[model samples]
Target: MRLFEDNIHIEIPGRSTPSARSPEAEPSLDGKVNSVSRREAVEAFLRLRLFMPERQKRIVATCMNGEERQYFFDKMVEIAATVEGMPVTYQQDGNGDETIAHLHYFLGDCHWYITEKDREGEVEQAFGYAILHGDLINAEYGYIPITELVDTGVGAELDFHFKPTPMAQIKQALEDRYG
Candidate 1:
């Protein structure tokens, strides 16, 4: 099995692991995010997070040792929490979930997502929530030096998506080519 296929889990300080949640329960910070499905939230988060300037750079730093990986990972977790808390600050639904959210993150690249049927031939997303689909990665995050998911053109593509370009690598590529 692939390391990421169904094993995608991000650690939030207060939230349970995605692997631990029920098939219907999507992991949220304070309580259950029943309004927006887990898959949608995570995908929305991913769609925005990967495009950050700092985050884009972190993708390149993946070559670092284990300790460094932990450091960057922690930073990302922090970003996710900050974003999640944004909408909830105003008001909450009867379900204690927020309906309106402002995704201040992915405004840079105009990199939104278009979901096709997932590998299982099913897919969905929510405007209130977002997730980081390392699986849906097709473009490089602005400075991150990681290879992204390529469109297989066989099974359905993830409806939620983001565009990433390794800012660091692009700079390096330019330097190597010119200098």
Candidate 2:
């Protein structure tokens, strides 16, 4: 995977450098490609999670971040500290379901969630949400299903998926609650 930070490209295994005109690329100085910062990438990623349906976001995230859930939470803490000016503290809530998983973040009395609705193949769906003061503030919701583990010449692989949420809705919610 190739990650671009400020037009500097860092290539990961199995990822190639995209051409300047690639959809994921942006022309930078002398035809170099620029990419968003890690914080920006993380924010975009979290925002996108709200729109995914059920386990779709879970699958995509598994693919991108591998099986270590801590990586995802670590990034969230980074965002909370740097962008939200919140402490690096969080609490979680979920039902004890393997096929369906919910990762919740309680920050500053607000709740945020990235959830997978189907893990054992009952259904496939995933989403992200935020609530403040007992009111639903922002959400990204979508549904897609992956019935089985994918094998890419390695061991069993988990699926992580996500979709884009409305920026205006999220922005307004944050401004009202945190501003």
Candidate 3:
């Protein structure tokens, strides 16, 4: 197998702070929905469980910073430690289903995800996401599918498949020319 390195940094659009929900003092970044707070923007984004458009259903994007990113990362490490390469899928409502065969990565970052309604015989409706840490001011800022990212990374070590070969073939082909 030929191994290659990818350092594809994505250019995400900056989300300007939207108007506050109520008429009062403008909330600080930390207090806003996009804030690092548990009830902030990150949570809201997680709720919809968006799938990248059909054109790039395999792609996804998430952002966070300050305590939020760190907290998420640390929690990921802990959750990963307990899992034994179980096939898992996360839901917007915090529910997840486990399967016996699949690929994934950990501590992983997603700048964007391209979605695909089907992945081989998996029949999954969605497929990729990119984790990002913008807002240089904050030390932590990212959005990643904890299970997918973590499992993909530890896949081989735990005796399971990482990313699907078909997907990798496409990704590698893109990288060879212009991923």
TM-score against truth, every candidate: 0.22, 0.21, 0.19
List candidate 2 stretches off by more than 4 Å.
Answer: 1-31, 66-179
Model 3 lDDT per residue over 12-79, tens place: 36533333132222344465422233344334334323211221111212222221243443333332
Among these predictions, the greatest TM-score belongs to 1
lDDT of the candidates, in the order given: 0.33, 0.38, 0.30
Candidate 1, position 165, lDDT: 29
Q: Which is the leading candidate under lDDT?
A: 2
Candidate 3: segments with Cα more than 4 A from true spot: 1-38, 45-113, 117-150, 154-179
Model 1 TM-score?
Answer: 0.22
Error of 1 at 10 (Å): 30
**lDDT of prediction 2:** 0.38
Q: How many backbone clashes does candidate 1 have?
A: 30
